[model samples]
Target: MKTYLIATLAMAASAVAQPQKAETPSPEPSRPQMRAEQPAAPKPSRGAFDAMLYVSVQDPSMEWWFNVPEGFAPHISEIKKIFHNQEFSLFPFADNAKVKEGKFSISYSISMKSPDGSLTELVRGAKYEGTKVADDIMVACPDVIDFKLDGRFPEGLYKFFISAKDGISGEISEYENHIRLAEWSAPVPFTGKKLVSDYVRAFSLQPSPEALYSIVFSDDFDLEQKGAPNSLNYTYLGFMKAAFKKNMFLISHIRDSFKSLSDLNRAKFILILAILGEKGIDASALSEPEKRYQEQIRAFKLPDPYGKWDPFLGAAQIDMLWGEFFADGTYRPVRRILNILSHAKEAAFADELAEKSRAPKTQAEWDRYMLGRLYKAALKTVAINARKYPLVEQYCAWALLHGDIPEVSYEVLSPMLEHIREMKSPSGGESGENPKVRMPRIDVESL
Candidate 1:
């Protein structure tokens, strides 16, 4: 029980975030040549709709900020805005008719002033106008904007002043809007006592903001003199999407900061974070479908009445019959997939998916445990497979033992674990003998 758990969780998560972090963005290039680059881009015929990734991306002029697509920006009124929710990821889309053609410049300036001081020129004169294309409806691909705090932008109200001038029309649209940038998330050390991973899991996997405050109630721990969770210290989960990395980082920090923990709680706590870190929810690292699926999950609700959303993307692979979630997150799909995998002994798909889903990469010491977590995707299926595949059961049991939340673990798994036991013969398994699967004993030392 050496406290490598914190480091292991961080390492696993950082391993995924490292690539994006490695190329820490410097100033964006000024030219916006953006010309030759587009001609070579894959040509997909679709209406011109502007898309942008709103994460922590930087252009030459700005620190950590968002970028508008190079061309065909619709009128200020033309932008389609999706209001923030518990999911907090907003996709701003513009009509192709508003796409800017010819040479034009979009200048963005950001400034903030508080009672204590006046802040100006945090980023100014950041101009983007490139990729000359027709003004018609043939634009493909969504423009991306990365909105984030690189720890520089201060909290409080600030104006994001945007001015667009047509190089040909000699007409300009000027508008300025205020945005509140809160302090980005960071892990907090336990000021007094350590809480188990249950607190961490509850906070991170909160279905709604209303559910989180109690997880870290002041009555439970010393949260400064204020003795309560406050905006100054912690952010709402609604902001978790854009700041997901920061959120997880903060959670890991909490996990690592434990002043004390029982052996059992520590083991369970590490497993919860390790699995999530290994299986990231990074939008940058997901397919379009994956991005949508995750969106629904983050919101804890998927409105798929029209059948427009899918909850399983890469994990389902070619055969979605075994996928994990429905748009509404019912476990029917989980059950269906498990039944198929458990019965489809002629095919290797189930095992393959289980193996592939297990820590994409991990030290050998914890690989089996990771695999157990992975098999949790089809927990019921895992239970069935466990009778004949002891290793599969071991992994599944380990995964189901420590859920993303306590309720999830106990409510869903407690019965399942008991059912699994009931399926076995009194001696051990179905045939009064333990299945002799040759998987190595779980070596958690590396974990």
Candidate 2:
């Protein structure tokens, strides 16, 4: 019995010592290996943003910056009329928080959609690229973006849309606004339509002829058809500022070497003569003083006796050429051409222009006499005297549009032209019926 018990125990021990194979995990139902990553939550979608923005129809290459109205209502209605082929600037007020990244790009599109479902793309998906948040909050619009739009849209209610895309996050935010071009303010009156058509033909150029004179000389029809191009059409002041934009290409390239003021005496005189020839303004029609002056200039007509003038303008100007068209800046050339008739030209005006050119930001200190010289020179060929109220009014209208002088100064002249009187004071003053203007007491019948 003891032997049998020992064997039985050994057998039990053997049985206990024998190891069992591991059981395999049984496959229940076929299941996904990844627990289908809860399809990432859709990115946040912020509704359209209308940031504080300002538009400038200047050259496209200019440093187009951003501005948000300071806590007050924006005076967008005060914005003036715009034109075609104009460099339209669009800026979005961006801050550090919303941008989230240093680099981003904004896609811009402009279109005119009619109520009848006519979809016309004025600007389609043009990208303003390589943008970054600027250090100065005021000028946050990056230089990389093409802020200019080559104004081509016809008269219509057009929508302009801008979208910002975050490079890092792939998130997008968008903004939109609308603009309407009532009309490109043309030169006033019966003469302007014909002049504009003539300009379209005469100034017709593929890449724009090298210079104004070159265009005049190159095409036979251009010269033949462009009668009084300067006198009638403004050779140096086209609607697109084409006339006065001589060295503007340098500015377009963001180059610092732009000679705004140069010896345009030869150019000015030649252009004037060419246009005067077209006007059929008899050189004999000049007064005794002007006739004598023309005789003396007739000797040296080829090389015009142009004097010092600053054709030099920076960034922009009135009507793009109004200030220039006024010929106030053409002190030396206009004076030399007009001579005795140039009693209209004065010394004080030249000094003011020199100072202004030196310090462009500071406004010139000009007296009423100097003001007369500024406007009178432009009328050397046109204005026989101040009694020509229609001529005077025409000049006033041009000044209002182009801003030859400071807007503040025009305040003084506005009344004088309105009441058909002379400017008697520099700063504004009261009179019985009409306010006296800051002007010199001269015979309007004579220069």
Candidate 3:
């Protein structure tokens, strides 16, 4: 139940105001370079209209190649293999051009030739106006063009021909480049003793948190047997610590395992899955696992520990609902929160709070208002149930730290933090006199 609340908040802020550096691909000597480095064909002596096209694997990184000298020779040493879901950008720079009255026009066309010798036009006759930067310098109005290699495109080596026409001088410049489109490579499958040994080896190497997250959430990762629960021990401590540092790529592969688990086992995994889901992890690639999780929760017949309500179940549901609201800005999830509140007084207070809430006028306002309400409701749930279920205290700490609401003052959260600290025994024994609970863990070695 330990959350990356502080790290998550920091990441959220940095993501909004920063541009991410492009991912550098590993060296591959076998890849072919683009033919654009060759000399251009002789042009007619009438008027010179020259342009150069530069490619970047990431859109944000295009700025690095934007301001080359007029006679700079462009060379693509190697084109990295791109995943089907990834996107690359093309930037057209006008080296020499003719302009009239500080105005010029440029149009572009892009064609892809597949390995089978069939050609497909990805872009055709896209026009943009150009501005004269100086007496003889002209630049494209919108210099960047993005191409996404989604599912529609097949995996193969593709020959790309990019042509740009100078409308004023009736001259065209073309560049030939090659790129390979591919699918995300799956990890090699491992089970039983191999799984545990490999996982431990990977931990010892100190692989990046992002790399560890990918391995754990990959489709190839699985436990030894279905429905057999385990407990968190020293083995998973490193992985969980690394995973908590990441706030994105929160995908989980535990749905298949959860489907056949016992009531309490399912509930335990669901809570962990829900916490991860709040960070944008996909429960399933295409299916609605949210609906399935909810259905299982409704069928739970276990002893309720938090008075009339099951705090563990409620925590999972609330987390999932909050995640959904953040993703799609849907009001249905907010309405569902009222139904989940066991206390009429708390529900009534939430209802009144929603009723008195003013309509948001902008996107930022909308985010602030909606997120504020959801966190308030989450805080109320924690306050009512944290003392009853020690796990609830973890959830409470997660909410207070990760909510990022400006209205929540330190004076309000300081006491809660102190209370949580007091709940923990110095010797790391059972928290708050509560009996030690065997939380559900994945049994990788058994598989």
Candidate 3 on 109-157: residue-level lDDT in tens? 7666877888766556767664543323434324344555445567888
Cα lDDT of model 2 by residue, 303-324, tens digit: 1123332222110111223323
Candidate 3 residue 408 C-alpha distance from true site, Å? 26
Regions of candidate 3 where Cα sits further than 4 Å from its true position: 1-32, 35-48, 60-79, 135-145, 150-152, 186-447
Candidate 1, residue 185: the lDDT equals 32
TM-score, model 2 to reference = 0.28
| lDDT assessment of candidate 1 | 0.29
Compared with the true structure, all predictions reach lDDT values of: 0.29, 0.31, 0.42
- Best of the two (1, 3) by TM-score: 3
Top model number, lDDT? 3
**Candidate 1 segments exceeding 4 Å error:** 1-117, 130-155, 181-246, 256-268, 276-447
Scanning candidate 1 in windows of ten residues, the lowest lDDT window is 5-14
Leading candidate by TM-score: 3
Model 2, poorest ten-residue lDDT window?
1-10
TM-score per model over all chains: 0.28, 0.28, 0.34
Q: Which stretches of candidate 2 lie over 4 Å from their true place?
A: 1-54, 64-80, 83-117, 122-154, 167-172, 183-447
